[model samples]
Target: MLQSLSIRDIVLIEALDLDFGAGLSVLTGETGAGKSILLDSMGLALGNRADSGLVRQGMEKAQVTATFDAPDPASKLAVYLADNDIEIEPGEPLIIKRSVKADGGSRAFINDQPCSAALLREAGNRLIEIHGQHDDRGLINPRGHRALLDTYAGSDPAKVRQAFEGWQSAKVALEQAIADQEAAEQDREFLEHSVAELSKFAPQPGEEQELALERATMMKGEKLTGDLEAIRAAFDGSNGGLASLRAAARRLDRIGEDHPLLAEALGALDRAVIEAGEAEELLNKAADALMFDPQRLDDMETRLFELRALARKHRVEPETLAKLLTDMETRLAAISDGGRSLKTLEAGLAEAKSSYIAAAEMLRLKRQKAAKALDKAVAGELKPLKLDAARFETLIEPLDELRWGGNGMDRIEFLISTNPGAPLAPLGKIASGGELSRFILALKVALAEEGGAGTIIFDEVDRGVGGAVAAAIGERLAKLSKAAQLLVVTHSPQVASKGDAHFLINKSIAGTVSRTDVAALDGEGRRQEIARMLSGADVTDEARAQADRLLEGV
Candidate 1:
């Protein structure tokens, strides 16, 4: 419920602060008393559009703030505030403020944190709904009619919505699978041919690298083999260099003991001869190990080239050919099994769609039942509001095809015929402004609890009606207040008298500035105000007595 509203420099409102209470509160005054200005200031605080003209003549800017007291802090609006990074002060009212500058710049804030006007509007929508005489006619909108029906039904339409979403997902998957299978079927023969060719090739992992390494080894040693053979022949020949070195070493060792100095020289020569013999033997073994057949090298090179050419033809790296082979094999397997999978998916999709249809049908039936009850309830309200002969009906038209996530394929609208024997039409098309206002009030009274908590502001909904009809409207507004806060701006004394709290909006001039002043009235003050409404700028004793009676009844 709206707790308070503060306005500064907004048009005729120079500086004003008004506190609101729960239950029905009505604002009343004569024409040109700034009633509209008060409403506009409230609208601005509720995130309505702003204009530079709204600023007072001497002021640089205009600001309006609205505060609400939520019964539950975890309400939808509270959650939205948290999601938008707005601070939530503990035990404090939810404050929304809007400011417009003389230069046309505008800013909005939620809990003192700056926010976009769009965000403020969204938040305000959750907190309050202001319906004027012209605005209350929206109850006839087809889009809103279905929602009212569902709310009346008290069923979770979310179940049907979820089923629809699941059905859509299944359909999309089935379609994609069918498309893939069809494309695969078109290339069935080509896929078969490729599978057969690649199977014969049988590309092995790391085979290319192994073949290249073998070819390299064989090619590098092929010419070296002849030179190694020549070296081996020289070392193994009888009386070759090794044999001569051995004989020289023996001769040197035998004479070494004859003389001390000469012995040292002979020892060193024998060591050198022995080392030369060992070198020759090592060279002979190395040469034998290096030998390879030229034909083997040519064969290895041919096999490596074959692998490289296959890699190029397949448009893959030599190493990646193996993975390509595996992928092709998997594709072939899928092609072989695709027909069976397609059948399974088709059956699953059919089952999901069937479930959705069943749920939707059930929901549609429930909505139909709910619609009848709502029509009867609203019709009962019309008589007291002076539409005793009018007929209200709920028209439920089921669409030909089911729309996923919609309200169960039913396009529900409220239809009304204002006079007896009149042709029924869409409520908005048939009902006059006054009739629409009453209709909306009837619906609001019918669905009072289901619409959630918020301050409901009825802006002159009693327009074009008077006497008992206006009194009935006031009664219903008072009844609505039991569930949520109710605020009415009205010219009717009947409605004004029913208010738990009364405010008078009047224009005043102070120091060459025109300002709108709102004052909460009590006792005699409220009686005088109601009497003024009853007598139009004059308060008579009879009107005051009538106001007192109305207040007592309320």
Candidate 2:
């Protein structure tokens, strides 16, 4: 609830600070007593648009501050403040201040921390709802009807919202998968043929270098074989040194026993013969290895050419062809399995849709029951507010499939008929301004404990009807106060009499300046104020007696 409001240099109000209490408080005065100015001051603090004209003459700026007793720690105000990085202690006062400059600029603050006007508006809306000539915060707007109805029905709609989101996610995934499969399908045949070709080629890493070395050796094999064989023959052939060496070694051995000198020469000749035999063996091995065939070299060259050609055709390095084959095979496998994957996602979507439907159905049924009770309750209030023939209803109907949302499939509207035989219609077409004010009061009374701002300001809610109707309006306002604070601006004496606190709005002129002043009335002050409200321009003994009776009842 609004704990206090302070205004400075705002139009007729120079400086004023008013403390408010719980339950209903009434502000009363004659015409042009600055009652509207008081409300304007409050609106400014709540982030309403401001202009330079609102600043008092000669004043640099106009300021208004509204302080509220903190809402529950879990309230929307707390959430909004947290989201904006504004910290406040629990149970502390939530202060919102707005300043309008003479230059057509404005600033806002929440809890003394500088912030945007939008944030102040957000926090302001959670603290107080002003229902005036414009029903901006009322149920006339269709957007809020569902949440308000949900609050009255006492059902959890978040579960259905969550289910709907899950269903949407599944649908999105299925669509993306289908698109991917369609793109892959365009290249299916090419992928299959490529995979098959690569599998057959079976390219190996480092195979190119090995093949090149072998081709070089085979291409020059004829020349190398000839050179090697000639060298072998020089050492191993009978016409070569091996046969000669054997003949000389045998002769030396036979003569070595006849003379010591011949023996020493035979020893040297025998060593030379052994070394020549070893060299001939090595030459024979070399001669055998050098015997190459052209047909074998041709086969090797043909294989190397195939590898090079295949590498070129594939547009890949010879070593990476193996990796390409593996990747192509994997993509083909995924595409082949896409149909099954899509089916799985479709099943998930169906399950989520079913869950959402069940929850929404349950919520709609409860809302239907709540609507009936609400209509009947509001109907019960109409007769006392002088709308005895007025009909009130809660309209709930299914929306189109495409228009369905997280709120549910239901579109809720409040309809009314002011006279008998009148067709029930929307709030705008139902009645006059006075009738609408009474209707708003009835609705407020009925949804007294529902989710809403902590403070409700009814701007002349008892505007039309009088006598018993005014009293009934006052009674209902009092009833609403049991759950939340209320600020009622009214000229009705009955309504004014019902307030826990009464404030008199008066205009005073000091020389060239006229200012509006608000004073909380005491006993005699209350009597005089009530008497003035009862009898305009004069207060008589009879009006005082009536006012006394009213106060005595309170």
lDDT of 2 by residue, 1-554 (tens): 89999999989999999999999899999889898899888888887787778999999999998888876778778987988999888888888888999988998888889998787877777778887766656566766777888898898889889988987888898889899889889879999998988788787878888878867765565768877777777776566787888888798888889999999998888888889878877766655554466787777688778877877887988777778788889889989998899899889889988988888888899999999999988999999999999999889999887877787889998989998999999886666877888888888889987858889998888886788888889899999889989999998999998999999999999999999999999989989888887887889999999999888766
User: How accurate locally, in lDDT, is each candidate?
Assistant: 0.81, 0.85
* Model 2 regions lying over 4 Å from their true place: 203-323
What local lDDT score does residue 346 receive in model 1, on the 0 to 100 scale?
87
Q: Which ten residues in a row have the lowest lDDT in candidate 1?
A: 132-141
lDDT score of model 1? 0.81
Clashing residue pairs in candidate 1 are 12-516
* Deviation of model 2 at 191, angstroms: 1.0
